[model samples]
Target: MIKLLIADDSALMRKLLQDIFVAEGDFDIRLARNGAEALDLVRSFDPQVITLDVQMPDMDGLTCLSQIMIEMPRPVVMVSSLTAEGAEETLEAIELGAVDFVAKPSGAVSLEIDRLRPVLVEKVRAASKARIRRTLRLTERVRHQMRSAVTARVRPKPARRRPVSGAGKPKQKPGPSALPGLVLIGSSTGGPAALDAVLPSLPGDFPWPVLVAQHLPASFTGPFARRLNSECQLSVVEVGNPMPLQAGTIYIARGDADVVVAARATGIIAMPAPARASYLWHPSVERMVLSALECIDAERMLGVMLTGMGNDGAAAMKKLSEGGGRTIAEAESTAVVWGMPGELVKNGGAGLVRPVDDIAEAIVELVGAHASH
Candidate 1:
C-alpha cells in the first residue's frame, strides 16, 4: 500500500479527501489540519506522497512546501483553488519542487468534489512514482526566488510581434508548399519547471515558432504564459484565438482545449479547438502534432517530448520520425516522470535523447543547422 498524507485546514476537505482515497483501498493514509501538523507528520509518517492544500492556516502551504523540499525532498501534489491567485501560488509550488497540482472546484466546499476524485487519485498515483531531484529543485528554487525578488514590481511585457504572412517568411524552405520548420513541444506533470529550464535558455532570435502543448487548466495557462514571457527572451502567449504563427514566438496551448495549426491563405495560424473525447489529456499533444503534420511536411518539423505522466506524444512523434522529422526525448536522468519521453525512446522515435538542461542547446543546434542549409 502507498503511504499518503493529506494536508488541509478544512475539516470537510480533509474528510472528503480521506473518504475518496479510502474508497481506493490502495493508500494507507494520514491527515493533517494545517501546515504545521503536516510538517510534523513529514518527519514522523515519512509518507511517500503528499497532497498539500495551498490555503492551510498556521504555516501556509508555500512555507511548508519550502521546508519540506529542503529537508525531505519527496513528491508533493498541491490542491489549489481555481482563482487567479490560486494559479500563481500553484506555479510557485511547482518551482518549489511539487510534482503537480489539482484545482479545487469553486467555493470553499464544492459539489464538484466528487468530480475531482478520479483526477485526484490519478495525480497522486503519478506523484508517488515521480523523481524528486533535490539538487535541481534547490537550484531552481533559489534562482526563481532571486529573480522574483528583482521583478516583483515590473509587469511582464505584452507580446509584441504580430502574425507573419507567408510572403514575409524566410526563403529557406524546400518548396512553396513547405512552411519554415516548426518546433512542436509536448509536456505534462513536471512540465512547468522542465520548460523553465529550456525556454529561457533559447535566445530571443530563435529561428522557428515554438508550440507547446502542456496539460493545464484554463485559468492556469494564461498565468503560465505570462510567467514564461517574463522569464524568457522569446515572447510567449497562450493560444486563445486563431493567431498567426510567427518566428521567435512561443505559443502555449490554452488549457482545457487542444491547439491545432491550419493553413491560412496568408500564413499558418494556431487556434484553440474544442477538446476531443478521443484524446485523454487536454491540450493533447497527440492531436496537436497530428494537426500540424497535415499542413507542414515531416522533414520541416521537430518534435520534443518532455517529462510527463503518460505517453500522449509518443505514437504521433513516432509517426513524425518515420516520415523524416527530427525528435528529441528528455532523458530519464533529468525527467521527474519519464513516462512520455521514455515511450518515445523505447519505440525508436527520438533522434536525440538529452537531459532537461541540454534540450535547449540541442534544439538551437538542430534547428539552426536546418535553417542554414
Candidate 2:
C-alpha cells in the first residue's frame, strides 16, 4: 500500500481529499490539520506521498514543503485553489521539489471536488515512483536569493552538479552546421522546473522554432508561459488560437487539448488537439512528434525528452531518430521520474543522454550553430 498524507488547514478540505484517495483502496492515508501538524506526522507516519495545501494558517504550505524537502525528500503534490495566487504558489512549489499539483474544485463544500480525483490519484502514484532525492535541497534562503535575482533580470548562478556514470554525453560534437530545422520537446512531472532551466540557456535569437508539449492543466499553462517569459532569453507563448509558427519564440502546447502541427501554405499552422487523437495526457508528446513527422521531413529535426512520468513520447522519438534526427534524453541521474526518457534510452532512441543542467548548453552548442544564423 502507498503510505499517503493529506495536510490542509480546512477540516472539510482534508476530509474531502482523504475520501478521494480512500476510494483508490491502495493507499494508507494520514491527515494533518496544518503545516506544523504535517511536519509532526511526517516523523511518525513516514508517508510515501504527501498532498500539501498552498495556504495554511500558522504555517503556510510553502514553508512546510521546503522543510520537508530539506529534512526528508519524498514525493509531494500541492493541493491548491484555482485562483491566480494559487497557480503562482503551486508553480513555486513544483520548482521547489514538489512533484506536481491539483487545483481545488469550484466551491467550499461542492461535490465538484470529485472532478479532481483522477489528477490527485495519478500525481500520488507518480510521486511514489520518484527517486526520493534529498541532497542539496533549496532552502528558504536560496529561494529568496533566486527571486531577488529574477526581479533584477539578472540570472542567478545555478548550483553545481556532480557527474553521474552511465549517462553517455554526446559522442559526436555539434559541428558548425549541426543545427536542426526544428526542435520538439515533451515532458511531464518535473517538467516545469526543467523547462525553466533549459529555456533560459538559449540565446534570445535562437534560429529554429521550438515546439513543446507538456502534461499540464489548462489553467496553469498560460501562467507558466508568462512566468518563463519573464526569466528566459526566448519569448514563450501558449498556443490558444491558431497561429503560424515563428523562430526565436517558443510555442507551448495548450494543456486543455492536443496541439497538432500541420504544414500550410503559410509556413506551419497550430491546430487544436482533436478528440479523435486519443491520448493518455493532454498535449500528448507522441501525437505532437507524429504530426510533426507527417507534416515535415525530420532529417534536420531534434527531439529532446525531459523529466516526466511515462513513455508518452518514446516511440515517436525513436521513429524520429530512425528517420535521421538528432535526439537526446535527460539522464536518469537528474530526472525526477525518468519514465519517459528512460524508455527512450532502453529502446536506443536517444543518441545522447546528459544531466538536466547540461541539456541547454548542449542545445545551445548543437542547435546554436544553425540557430544563430
Candidate 3:
C-alpha cells in the first residue's frame, strides 16, 4: 500500500480526499488539519507521498512545502483552487519541488470534487514514484527568490494579442525561404520545472521556433506562459488563437484543448483546436505532432519528450523519427516521472537521450548542424 498523507484546512475536503484514496484499496492514509499538523506528521508518519492544500491555516502550503523540501524532501501533489491566483501559487509550488497538482472544483464545500477522483488518484500515485532532486530545487529556489522581487514590482499582464494578419486566418502564403525548422516539445507532471531548466538555456538568437504542448487546465496556461517569458530570453506566448510561427519565440499550447500547427497560405501558424475524442490528454501532444507532420516535412522538425507521466507523445515522435526527424528523450536520471520519455527510448524513437540540463545544448548542436547542411 502507498503511504499517503493529506493536509487540508477544511475537514470536509480532508475526509473527501481520504475516502477517495481509501476506495482505491492501495493507499495507507493519514490526515492533517493544516500545514503545521502536516509537517509534524511528515516526521512521525514518514509517508511516501503528500497531498497539500494551498490555503491551509497557521502555515500556508507554500511555506510548509519549502520546509518539507529542505528538511525532508518527498513527492508532493498540491490540491489547488481553479483560480488565477491559485494557478500562480501552484506553479510556484511546482518550482519549489511539488511533483504535480490537481485543481479543486471552484467553491467551498464542493461535491463536484467527485469529478476529480481519477485525476487526484493518478497524480498522487505518480508522485509517489517521482524523484526529488535537491540540487535542482535549491538552484530554482534561489533564482525564484531573485525573480520574485523583480516580478512583483512589474509583472506582465496576460493578454490576447492579435495574430499577424488582422484577419482570423493567414491572408497570403510566404515563400518557402521564410520557412524555419520547428521544435515540438510535449511534457506533463514535472513539466514546468523541466521547461524552466531547458528553455532558458537556449540563447536569444536560437534558430528554430519552439512549440510546447504541456498538460494543464485552461486557467493556468496564460500565467505559465507569462512566467516563462520573464525567465527566458526568448519571448513566450500562449497559443490562444492562430498566430504566425516565428524564430526566437516559444509558443506554449493553450490548455484544455489541443494546439496544432498548420501551414497557412501566409506562413506556418499555431492555433488552438477543440480537444479530439481520439486523444486522452488535453493540449494533446500526439495530436499536435501528427498535425504538424501533415504540413511540415519531418526532416524540418524536431520532437522532444520531457518529464511527464504518460506515453502521450511516444508513438507520434517515433513516427517522426522514422520519417527522418530527430527526437530527444529526457534521461531517466533527470526525469521526475520518466513515463513519456522512457516510452520513446524503449521504442527506439529517441535520436538522443540527455538529462534535462543538457537538452538545450543538444538542441543547439543538432539544430545548428541541420541548419548548416
Best by TM-score: 3
lDDT by candidate, in order shown: 0.87, 0.78, 0.87
Q: Give each model's clash number.
A: 0, 1, 2
Locate the minimum summed-lDDT window of 10 residues in model 3: 163-172
What are the models' TM-scores? 0.90, 0.83, 0.91
Where does model 3 exceed 4 Å of error?
107-110, 139-177
Off by over 4 Å in 1: 107-110, 135-179
With candidate 1 superimposed using the best TM-score fit, by how many Å does residue 89's alpha carbon deviate from the native?
0.8
Candidate 1 achieves a global lDDT of 0.87
lDDT of 1 by residue, 324-372 (tens): 9999999999898999999999999999999997888899888877988
Q: What lDDT does candidate 1 reach at residue 340?
A: 95
Least well predicted 10-residue stretch by lDDT in candidate 1: 162-171
Count steric clashes of candidate 2: 1
**What TM value does model 3 have?**
0.91
Taking every candidate in turn, the Cα RMSD to the unseen true structure, in Å, is 5.2, 6.0, 6.1
Residue 186, model 3, lDDT: 95
